[model samples]
Target chain A: MRPIVLATDYGTSGAYVGQLKSAIYTVAPGATIIDLTHELPEFNPRASAYLLASFLEYVPPESVIVGVVDPGVGSARLPVVLEGDGYTFTGPDNGLFSIVARKLSKARWSEILLSSEPASNTFHGRDIFAPVAVQLASGSTPRLAPAPAEDRAGIQWPDDLHEIVLVDHFGNGVTGIRYRPSDQERIMKVHGEKVRYAPAFHCVGPGESFWYGNSNGLIEVAVREGSAAERLDLKTGDPVGFDAAG
Target chain B: MRPIVLATDYGTSGAYVGQLKSAIYTVAPGATIIDLTHELPEFNPRASAYLLASFLEYVPPESVIVGVVDPGVGSARLPVVLEGDGYTFTGPDNGLFSIVARKLSKARWSEILLSSEPASNTFHGRDIFAPVAVQLASGSTPRLAPAPAEDRAGIQWPDDLHEIVLVDHFGNGVTGIRYRPSDQERIMKVHGEKVRYAPAFHCVGPGESFWYGNSNGLIEVAVREGSAAERLDLKTGDPVGFDAAG
Candidate 1:
């Protein structure tokens, strides 16, 4: 059986995910459709890209990964399939595969121009990417779809360090910092001040703040029994800094 | 936020899935835990094995897949962590990963000897596997805990031709055939006659019997707007046969 993972910005409240699954199953009856996440924050391609890149490696080889964060559904934005390292990615030409391609040894891409079919202005997830993914999962070659346009721009991660891309459900601000146990013995510096590590989110003394590298390889700031984002007045994209000192 | 996928046979009725997620979040604060499926049949390792082997590739790579379908929880059974390309799988040592490992390269297995701790007999999904999965999600090493023994016996797919593993929500008896479209196109010679394929479950001719693959990839025998399992005296695990032709 073939496995297909779907990552989309479509929230779970609608028929978007269901319709897409039905369409795929319509074409490939044996295909196992896995929902990576339909709850990606709406139309946030960067967020979608990060979420996809972080989890793409776990999918089995030969599995088709369908990403539909397309804000440019019916526009000139091209639908593309990136094939590499025993896996395939199908999504809009928007930089969805850029981060993914960086992680693989080899990647070949093709653009999907199936826009001539009757498609909705609002839902390319159901119309475009979903069908293309079904075809791929059914053993159709990537090149069988429309050829990808040459010189199309791929996505790029920000390098200026001006914003952080994640916030916890409890509103704790986290940065992309890989944590190590050795760092625990050292004094942690966040935003230029020495801080202590809390055992749990609430382990810090009341009103006392701290920083630690969370399991997801990110630096998280939290306040005991309180909202850290509220206490620090931090939002999702706010910039922060940290350093470990002996 | 980090994504964690839960795969279990606990079925979605009780507080099992909810409590597992609560325990996970309590340990790894602010993490987003996704329920892959709680609808797996109870205590059926082969079904859980097949389901996980089929769908685990669709989840994000860093996501922790927590699978609990153990029929031998508090006994000599072992909790295990199997690390493979881009994903981590936590479950009992009942051969859940055996099917998946055959399809992947370089699987690192570790036994979680957490049985020595205070644990529950009925709910290892909540006590052992869930907590260990949270620690794993929080970036704990698999070797952090006592090493579980390796080379445990794996699950064997039932060789009996007529065995059924699941009866879905719609009362469709899902057989082990794992149907594909090619199989659906070819008529199955059953009971000394060719059984024609019905386009949909309800597409069977009036007062006629039909069989076809349902949307979830299981071969189903059904009558239009009727229960074929009941009419045909078919219960789960009963042996049934279809000619290889279709």
Candidate 2:
């Protein structure tokens, strides 16, 4: 079985993540589970979509990603399985898989039909999606209905989000803007502060805040040894606009 | 090969943890890494010791437990590998493994001698401990020298601690005390306040605080649908003394 990459809003200290792994182990005992992350910004599938897309490029190829940032858990939102390039995503159809779908155009997708199996209305991520993720990772054909490529029901959001999508443990806010890396000075204006871009933390002065293309190839705001969010008083979903002076 | 369980103070939002797992995977390609927890309170090995001991029972048997809460990382403090009943631990010998050593008495231990291998002066958890952890998990006996169990250097702490060892994300404070389950009105006094115990959250009134034996069999302070740490002004290592009228 290919590895299962678990990405969820289930905080690390909690029991939910443990149960998710237990679920996978019970079904696919030979499966390997890698945590892409669990401390995803709570209940924001749009942001998780980009993060899932970004992480897909870094993880093991042919890996099955289980993305679960579902806020509309018990709602009428459909559950989904997005088959990206050499990777698979299992989550809600709440636009969580949309960016991943966009990232790999040749991607195939399907909707998990409504089920009567015992599950909590608020935690389908565990009861519903996790079991299906194991099935996919275990090389079993899960019950899936085709979701056409043109079906943009969950993907009404913009292609490249301008808002802050992720705030890391160090309080570095990762923006949704994708850019190529270069030594040339790149700058982004957030709120009223101009964040200069550097290639790495060493290139910037101590305690200096800068934007850089991170290991994941996305523009990120960071401080050399301090917190970028704290220094700039930034939060997720805050806008980062192009620097006019640049 | 048994699984590799990572217990560290390395916060999740940083690159350190990803890099740590990356280091493990580079050496032990088949190793399945389970993050026992990362958001350990920074640099307090006493609490981390108890937490590590508590987690040992919950993880997979015969697993390699890589514990690192090294405040004295680059110092002359020895690095050690403890072989437990059915598990192994590799980390700094700065009392991080003391509780686990005490928990399983038949355990054997060894020291990883100062080596010529290139290592970071600061980040030894990544440079030194993670690689050793991978070696243990990958069924390789890393070069280890005999260290007597009677060596009182790290195991001098009390068998059962009386102070708060951990304060978790939900603001619940976990103490190093243990107790049996019963319906009796258990009580604990802290900071001139008498805290009564309840079995589950539902047993206590909403927003009321209580002490109980948590899942890992340690006493914990929690508020039902509220922040116990915030309300009680609790931090790690704060005193949680015994019940007087028990």
Candidate 3:
């Protein structure tokens, strides 16, 4: 079995993410669980979708990724299992998997029923999705009902985007726009400030904010030794355009 | 082999933690790495000390815990490894593991030589400690020169403390003081605000604030549906005492 990956907005603290891991461990002892990230912006399904699409490249094939940025957790939204090119995702139908569901070469989705594992009004991530993720890792295909691809959450985003998707610990803002080597000449502007293009952090001058390709291949805004997000007041979902100064 | 756990102030979204994991994977392929928490109060060793002391109980025995709350990351602080009761710790001797070193039975201390693994001026957690952790997990015992136990960082604090250790996403503050079920009648006072004790969150009405034992067995301050830390202006290291309203 491939590793079980967790992508959520559970942050680094609190007991939520740990509980999810515990749930997996209880069923699949010695299962490898990789935390791609747990710092997604809560209640922002589009950003979660974008992050999942980019981050899915890093996980091992056949891995089951559980993404739970569902703000409508207790709402009438559906629970789902989406099979991407080679990855499986189990989470809320609130569009968290929208981008991946559309971009993957082969995307097949099914609505999951949770009669055995009753979820609370909140935290279906822990109750419904986690147990289901363990069952998937255990090689058991649980019951699945049909759901239209249009009903997927965050399905409206295009295959690529030009907005901030993540702000890293160094305050570098990772944009949803994939980097093209041919487009290194293209600079990005945010909040009226022009950012030139740099290939990596050390390539830029100290305290100068520049765009670079992160390890995950997203175009990221960063300073040499300082924080780009702080220097430019950039955050997730902030719009970007071709720098007028260019 | 026990899982390798990580606890640090390396906030989510940095290439820092990922780099550490990548370095570990380079040496130990398919290693199971668990993130205990990364939201520690950076530069505050005491808070990290308290958090490690409490959180260690949950990790698997014989696990190598790479704790990296190194405010003095590049400083001359001695890099050390501690063999605790059933687990091992690797990080700077910067007091992050002070509590666990003292309390764990048969604790052995040693200074780690980094000549084999040259550490950069910054981010020893990635270059030095992470490699050492991988070596430990690989079942290879590296050289450990003798070091005085007193030389351990942050060893001055007592076993039991009365300070706040963390504030979670829900605005709940996790305190260093362990909850004695017998002391339920003893209300806790923080910043002169008295907080009555409740066995659990559901015991209180909506929007009500109370102290309860979190799943980790630590006493935490929380509001039923609100944020206790936000409402009370509580933060890590705020002193806690018995309420005068007794």
Candidate 4:
């Protein structure tokens, strides 16, 4: 069976992430659940959308990816399942899957029609998305109605965003801009600080700030042996600009 | 097959935790790996010890738990396999398993005689502990030599510690004290701030600080809808005191 990958904003703090796993394991004891990340920028599904999309290439094909950065958990947002390329995505309809759908070929969106009301209004990740993901992984058909493409959240969002989307534990600021080797000569500006390009950390001196194509194929700002987030005062949603190197 | 549970201080950053999972999957693709936590107090096995012990009652029986909070990864510390109660543990023998051993009846310690030197000195969690855990989970015997109890690190340490061992993402301070129903009347003091006892977070008003028995059965300090870590200026390793309430 394809791995059930969990991507959430639940920071692994309390019982929420554990409950997601328990909810999955309760039915499918043999299912393999991989935590893609639980520390996505909290409540900012727009930023999380780009970051989650960046990880799609690394995840195994045909995997069930559950992205739950829903700030509208108790609101009227729809729960969705989007089949992108060979992967199946489950999460709230709040544009979290928008970038993911765009990156994959022949993506299809569907609204999950629950068999019954969820146990809690505040935790659809455990109640709705996890069970739905388990059903997908187990090859069982869930009640899903075709969702219109026009109504999809973030459908009109730019293919690539130009803001810091995640600050990882190393203090590396992962921006939404895709990094290609062709753009090696460009300088990236964040919070008024100019960062030149480097292929990798060792290419730069200690404590020097630089931008690089991270392993996930995104432009990540980092300070060698230091915190780039601290040096540049960067956080998620901070705008980043690109310019030709002087 | 028994499940492999990972507890580390790797903090879900960078690629350490992912690599540990990959290492296990590479050997045992069917392994059910549960991340008990990766956010243990960094480089301090003494604190991690009490916290790991607190979770022992909750983990499934006969699970192979891999605990890696080693500050001396590349050093002379031995990689050890410890059996406590029915569960097997693999990690650096730097007192990470000390408290765990004390908690379980008939615990035994053995030095892992590696067939080859670990590929990387700094990441025994990936190279040593993960593989060892897979072997145990797969019902295979790893090459282990009996380690004397007298040579064990933290063998003579106190049964309980009086310090905050972990500050969780919710800003709740988890101390080393085991909470029982009898301790409800005791007042807890941390960093010169006195806190009363409450049955749980909901028992107190918003922003009111109190101490309670956490789900894991440890005394935790928290402020409802606020951060106890900030409210009491608490951090891991900060001393905590208990007194009878007037």
Candidate 5:
């Protein structure tokens, strides 16, 4: 069975994540559901988009990746299916899919039509996206109509967002900037602190702040044996910049 | 394939939960893993025990529930398997499973004999607990020997604790007290505040503090449309009291 990956802001503590999984299991009892992360910059799809995209390479190619940071749920935003680079995507038409679409070559956008079934205005993640994800993951096509990728939200957004997209439990700040090898020579500036490059946590002294390419290929800020978030006063949506190391 | 349920203090943001899942999937590719919750009271298996026991009713009886809150990771703590009330559990031989065992009838304890395989000392959740959970869930029992249940950690702990065991994302404080219908007329006192009973959040005015039997059948303190944790200055390990409501 094709795996189903869930990315959402519903949070793990609440019933929302459980309800979403139930919807999927109700449809596909044998489905393999992987929670990429439910704590996705709550309700901020623009920031979540980058984090979700960063995890794309780690997911199985046949996986159905469901991203649901829908702040405009029950609004004018349309539910969408974007299949690209051997993976299928399902979620609201908000910029949640924009970065993933751009990252995956030959992406095709399609709108998932409502089947005259009523859904909760506040929880389309469980009501709509989950079932559609299950359908695609089960090798069944959902009701869809070809849509213009250009008209999608965040289509024109920058490829690289120079902002903190997520903060891990270890207090490491994950930026939206996809790391390149040459980028390691630059100093990262965030919260008015200059963070030099470090290959790994052990490369720096305890409590020393540094930046490095994380496993997901995103530039991340961390402090050895301490919380970079606390040390730098960093949080999601905080601006970050790069400069040539002097 | 039998399902595997995970309950831990790994928190949602870190790689621990993902690594745990990956370990199970690596061995049992078709396994269905449910993350009961990764945000258990960190390193306090005494508190996590009550919270884990409360969630047992919601899990499928055939599940292999893995509970890990091992502060003694590589220490002298024994790794064990517990079979009880139609469910199988694998984790450190800590108090994490004590409350769950007490709640279930006809519980049996078994020690999981360590193989010659090298395992990580710090991440037994992934290396030890997960693989053992998958083994039991797959109908293939691991090497085990009968152990005395009385000698296990937390065997003498209270049936119901009066301290806060968890503070969820919504800021509700879930106490270790199991709700009884007759207790409705009683007032719960915590953090120097007296809280009356309410059947549901809707029964209380916005921002009004009240206690209720939450879905998991635990007595929980909450403030409608606001944060009970913030309002009462409540947190895990905080003591609570009960009094007859006049």
Candidate 6:
């Protein structure tokens, strides 16, 4: 059976995650559904994109990744599907898959249009993306739903590499560093200091501030015995570091 | 912050889940841990063992997975640190990692001996497994606390496959088949002019019933629109199946 991973801005508190799973099961009937995360901070598309893109390589190939961080659902923003590198992506066209597509190099994409039947203004997660993903998981052809849009260029990477997109549960601000640990020291400078690689999260002194390459392989600012995001008053999507270095 | 995922048999309503997370964060400051699941049924080691073995592949390779379904925590059972395939697994060594280790093939394991350190009889999940997992995530080597045990070859897989281990939220009985669609057809057998593979949960029709094959890739008896685990007298680790083919 094909594995389908769901990445969304929907938090676990609501029925949103459950409903989406139910819908996928309704259509696919026998699909293996795994939750990448439903607790992404709401409507943070870039954050959602970064999280999905960072973890995309680890999931099994041919896995259908459905990302639903659309604040622009039912609007002019297009719902699209991109097939590339032995994987399928279904989500909004707002640059969510850009990083992933860029990493994979070649992506076959098509903009999705719902049937002439009336669609809900809100909850496109349930109405649009979930059903489409279900069908796709069940081996339905992509051409059955909608035709491809004429212009399908990839999205441009954000100019600032040091921009923080997600502050996780421990309040460590996660950045979008498209660099490996070897190249990270030179690619970006943080807080007027060259980024240092600590052996582990608490390798630095207790309560002392430190910057290191995170497990996600990005430069992150953290505290040894406290919350860096909380103490620094950082939230998701806040830009950090000098623009010239990026 | 490092991400820690918990796989435990402590049901959600209990204080075990809360305490484990609390203890983890207490020791490993600035850590971002997540619950893979806390709803595992009681101390059913086979259930917890299989669930962890099946799901660990989907998570990031370096993730620290804490499995705590120890019925023999303070008893003769060994507490172990298993290092394998970019992942670290901590739990009671009651053959929980046996299936996982076999699946990964490259798994290198060592036993965690905390006997001299003193531990609680009832709650080794908090004192032993939880703390060890936290320390591991906080950047400690496995040798910090205990020396390795020589006889690490005794771990074994569950011999019986007919028992139902977990009934999911939908009342689908999660069975040993790890039910995939390919198993759907073979699930029903012809017995003396009788036919099976009917899509009903119980001996009913026109409503949701547990047949077989669920999202987890297991042979489950699931109620389509309701809870079959509730409707029929099924609970965690209950034996279930058709006596005769068809």
Best by lDDT: 4
Clashing pairs in 5: none
Per-residue error for B96 in candidate 1, Å, reads: 23
lDDT (10s digit) by residue, model 1, range B202-230? 56565566778766555666666666656
- Residue runs of model 3 more than 4 Å from their true location after superposition: A2-9, A12-136, A139-246
Select the stronger candidate by lDDT from 3 and 4: 4
Put down candidate 2 lDDT per residue, A1-246, tens digits, no spaces: 777878888877769889888878887887777776887778787777776676655566777888888888788877888886788888877887787788785888798875576368877777888888888877787788998767745567777778788887666788877756553465688888888876566566768888877656567887865678888888877888667776
Q: Which residue pairs show backbone clashes in model 2?
A: A169-B13
lDDT of 6 by residue, A12-31 (tens): 66698888888788877766
| Per-residue lDDT of A70 in model 5 | 81
Q: Model 6: per-residue lDDT, tens digit, B65-140?
A: 8877764544577778787777888887776666677667567667775545533344567667777887788787
**Candidate 4: residue B58 lDDT (0-100):** 51
- Model 2 C-alpha lDDT per residue in residues B1-246, reported as the tens digit of each score: 788888998787534575577556656658778889987766678888887888778999888888888765545678888886888888888888888888885888899865665334445776788778877776776788998877735678887888888889899999987766662475787776788878889999999999988999888989999999999999988888766775
Give DockQ per model, in order: 0.02, 0.10, 0.11, 0.10, 0.12, 0.03
**Model 4 CA deviation exceeding 4 Å by range:** A1-9, A12-27, A34-37, A40-246, B244-246
At residue B43, candidate 5 shows an lDDT of 60
- Identify the runs in model 5 with alpha carbons over 4 angstroms from their true place: B1-9, B13-27, B32-37, B40-246
Model 6: pairs clashing at backbone N, Cα or C within 3 Å: B178-B217, B178-B218, B179-B217, B179-B218, B201-B209, B201-B210, B208-B224, B210-B221, B210-B222
Q: Which regions in candidate 6 have their CA more than 4 angstroms from the true location?
A: A144-154, A183-196, A242-246, B1-5, B8-65, B68-109, B112-246
Please give the lDDT score at residue A206 for candidate 2: 69
For model 5, residues B1-246, the per-residue Cα lDDT tens digits are 789999988788644686677567656778888889988886689999999999999999789999998766656788988897789999998899999998778899999898854244456787788878888998887999999998999988999999999999899999999999899889898876789999998998898999999999999999999999999998899999796453
Candidate order by decreasing lDDT = 4, 5, 3, 2, 6, 1
Which residue pairs in candidate 3 have backbone atoms (N, alpha carbon, C) closer than 3 angstroms, thus clashing?
A: A94-A153, A95-A153, A95-A154, B95-B153
**Global fold similarity of model 2 (TM-score):** 0.62
For candidate 6, the share of real interface contacts preserved is 0.00
Docking class of 6: incorrect
